[model samples]
Target: MIEVQGLTKQYRSVRAVDDLSFEVKPGKVTGFLGPNGAGKSTTMRMIVGLDEPTAGSALIHGTPYSKLKNPLRTIGCLLDAKAVHPNRSAAAHLKWMAQSNGIATSRVKEVLELVGLSDVAKKKAGGFSLGMGQRLGLASALLGDPEILILDEPVNGLDPEGIRWVRSLVRALAAEGRSVLISSHLLSEMALTADHLVVIGRGKLIADQPTYEFVKEHSASNVLVRTDFVPEFSQALENENVEFTSTHDEEGREQLLIRDQTTDYVGNLAYSVGVPLTELTLKRASLEDAFMDLTSDSVQYHAEALPGEDSDAS
Candidate 1:
């Protein structure tokens, strides 16, 4: 297990990570999330001893990372896939890491196979594509068969198949009672892969909870209905004190977005009001929705919306 308490990092006048406290527990995949410039990378660096924290501590199995006698056997990380030497072959890279960590040379081959890089073991890392480099980095992370894993954008530049493979691999490792912490911008895949989430914004802790609970609390599911009697239905909804908004599609047909009500309730109300419905479906909120809602203010970079487009549009 990895425990962080009151962790902080200050660069001159800016605080990169401020009193961040969270735990990566065994038998589960904990997703570390934050917007750009939110200090996620800084916090991870402090946790792994890459950077000195200004305050507090990050402990792996009750020991600080710098104090670990066999760091690789206890924790493995892939913070940067391109950190390896450009001239080294995949096999040579893993072999050296294994030697440094007192791991068997045979284990290097095992991890290379596990990450599907055995076929390219003899190839220079500099020649590998982005996806192949990511695979090689994963192979090094697994070289020691560590009990804890920290992966930053492990699936970055991977194809759909490689993404799925990584999802399965981390989940399987967690199921074996190892702790896994992954940080990525892929919200959809994180929703599928992570059992829990640690959300931070602007170097402050925002949320720590189960994946389902986090989504349920931060996002709202709404019922969308399209009807012939738009006027009547709108009036009925107002009379029933149902919160709703009206919007038009590209073809200019009106639709009602009813919040705080289920599809069944909306359908029954439409039926009672003699409204003929063309569509009634629940629009469930995804992890992307929740992330956007929760971290809107924490995002340091903002992209201008297109003309006629609003943040709340649809």
Candidate 2:
């Protein structure tokens, strides 16, 4: 397990990370999330001893990273896919890292094949595409067979197939009792890959919970109902003190967006009031929705609305 306790970083007048605390447990994939400039990269740097924290500490299995004799064997991280030497072959890069960590040279071939880079192991890293570079970085992370993995935007340039492979690989590692902490802007994939989430805003911890619970709590889930007798249903809903919004569909059919109520409650209420319903469906919020809603205040950059677009949405 990896533990971050009261971790903090200061750059002149700005505080990049502010006393952040969390744990990445074994046998689970924990997603690290935040908006741009939310100190995600800074925090990860402090965790791996890349940057000195102004205060607090990050520990891997009870030992700080700086104190570890073989840090790579305890924690594997891919913070930057392009941090490799441009002139070196893919296999050569892995070999250097393996030698530095006293890892077996045979393991380089194994990891190259594992990340599907054996075919291009002799290619210079400078000529590799973005996706291939990412694969090489991943190979480096796995070279030590570390118990913990920290990957930042691992799927940044991957195609659909490569993205799916990453998802499966991380899950398989976690299944084998490894601790994985991944950071990505791909909310849909994060929702599928992460068992837990650590969301931060303005360098402070905003949420630390299971993926499902985080989405369910941060985003609104409503039951949308369409009915011919919209007037009666609206009145019934108001009488029950249930919260809802009213809108018209594309077909001009009136619908009620009932909140804090389940489909059964809406369906039963409609039946009791003799209202005929055309449609009743539950619309749960996705991980992207939850992330946007929760991080609205913490977003560092905001785009202006396009012409004829709603400013509120922008």
Candidate 3:
């Protein structure tokens, strides 16, 4: 497990990370989420000893990364996929990392194949596309066979196929009981990939919970109902004094947005009143929705909305 206690970082007057605390446990893929300049990179840097924390500490297992004799074996991180020498081949790059960590040179071939880069192992990293470079970086991280993996935007430049590949790889790693911490902006993929989430904003912990629980907590309980018998259905709802708002969908169908309501209740009500229904959909809150709602106040920066767009969305 990776443990952080009161992890804090300061740059003059700005507290990049402020008394942040969390745990990335083994046997699960945990997602790290935060907006730009929310101290995510700063915190990760602190964990890997690339940057000094103004206060508190981060532990890989029982020791700080700086104090570890074989740090690569304990934690594998891919903060930047293109941070390697541009002139080196994929195999040669992994070889150097393996040598530095005293790992077996033979493992380079194994990891290259693991990341599906064996066919292009001899290609110079400078010429490799972003997706290929990401694979090479992943190969280096896996070369050490570390117990913990921290990846930042592993799917940054990947196509649909590459995205799915990374998802499966991370899940496989977690299934083997490795602690995996991933950070990415792809909310839909994160929802599919991570077992849990660690969300932060403005250097403070906003939420830390299971994936489903976090989503369910902030999800809007809106039951959208559409029917050709709009007047009859609206009358039934009105007779029972059910709280709902009316709106038209993109297709010009009348839709009732009911809050604090369940599909069962709406369906049963319509059925009892003999109002035929065409569609009943319970719009569950997505990870993106929860992230935005929870971190609204903690956001340090804001984007101006286009004319006629909802300015209150952020």
Question: Which residue pairs in candidate 1 have backbone atoms (N, alpha carbon, C) closer than 3 angstroms, thus clashing?
Answer: none
The TM-score of predicted model 2 comes to 0.96
lDDT of 2 by residue, 1-314 (tens): 99999999999999999999999999999999999999999998888999999999999999889898777888899999999899999999999899999899999999999999999999999999999999999999999999999999999899999999999999999999999999999999999999999999989999999999999998888999988788889999999999999987888877889986899999999999899899999998899989998998998899998997877664
lDDT of 3 by residue, 88-149 (tens): 99989989888998899999999999999999999899999999989988887788899999
Give the Å shift of residue 279 in candidate 3: 1.3
TM-score of candidate 3 to 2 decimals: 0.96
How many steric clashes between backbone atoms does each model show?
0, 0, 0
TM-score, one value per model: 0.97, 0.96, 0.96
How many clashes in candidate 1? 0
Off by over 4 Å in 1: 311-314
> What are the per-residue Cα lDDT tens digits for candidate 1 across 70-156?
799999999999998999999999999999989989998898889998889998999999999999989888888999999999999
Error of 1 at 271 (Å): 2.4
State the C-alpha lDDT per candidate.
0.93, 0.93, 0.91
Candidate 3 lDDT score relative to the true structure: 0.91
